[model samples]
Target: MSKIFHPVSEQEALAELPRLRQRLTAKARHAHQYRGTEGKSLMAQAKRALRWHQLFVSINRRACQ
Candidate 1:
C-alpha cells in the first residue's frame, strides 16, 4: 500500500479552526494554572500564552499552505 501526499487547502484549515481554538484555550488555562499568580511566574505565563497564540497562527498558516 502507498501513502498519499495531498495539499492542505485554506478551507480545510479553516474547518479545523474551531477545534484548534478549543485546544489552545484549554492549554492556555492549564499553563496559567501552572504558572500561578506571581511576579516572574506570572510574566512567564503571559509569555507562554503569547507564544502559544503565535504558534497557533503559524500552524493555521502552514496548514493552509
Candidate 2:
C-alpha cells in the first residue's frame, strides 16, 4: 500500500493539538495497562505516541516564534 501524506497547515496543526493529546493519553494508558503482556501492540502505540508528540512540540515551537 502506498503511504498517504497530507501537509498540515498552521491552523490545522493548532486544531489537531488537543485531539492528538487526548489520543496520546489514551494510547499511553493502554500501553501502561498492558505493560507485562506479551505480543501486545506496544510498539505501534509507542510509534503513534512519538509521532503525535513530535508534531505537538513542533507546533508549539512555531507558535512561540
Candidate 3:
C-alpha cells in the first residue's frame, strides 16, 4: 500500500520539532526498558519521523537564510 504525502510548511515543521523530539526520546526509553518487538517497532517509527522533520527543518532553514 502506498502512503499519501502531505507537505508541511517550515513554520509547522519547526513547531512540531519539539513534540517529535520528546516522542522519540520517550520511545527510545520504552524500547530500552521493554526490550520487546513492539517497543522496538514504535521506536523505529518515531526515529523515522524525527529524522524526516529534522531534515526538513534543516533544509528549509538553509534555504530561507
User: How large is the C-alpha RMSD of every model relative to the true structure?
Assistant: 6.7, 6.7, 5.7
TM-score of 3: 0.52
Best lDDT goes to which candidate?
3
Best by TM-score: 3
Across 1-65, the per-residue lDDT of candidate 3 in tens digits comes to 01223455678877887887887887787686665588778877887887877776776665555
Q: Write the per-residue lDDT of candidate 1 for residues 1-65, one digit (tens) a residue.
A: 01223344566656766776676566556664554355456556656766765566566556545
Ranking by lDDT: 3, 2, 1
Decide which is better by TM-score, 1 or 3: 3
Which has the better TM-score: candidate 2, or candidate 3? Answer: 3
Q: What would the TM-score be for candidate 1 when compared with the true structure? A: 0.42
Model 2 segments more than 4 A misplaced: 1-5, 35-48, 51-65
Q: All candidates' lDDT scores? A: 0.57, 0.62, 0.71
Candidate 3 regions exceeding 4 Å error are 1-16, 26-36
TM-scores of the candidates in the order shown: 0.42, 0.45, 0.52
- lDDT over C-alpha atoms for residue 26 of model 2: 72
Taking the tens digit of each residue's C-alpha lDDT, what string does model 2 give over 1-65?
01233444566666777887776667666675664663257657666676876766575555545
Cα error, residue 8 of model 2, in Å, equals: 2.2
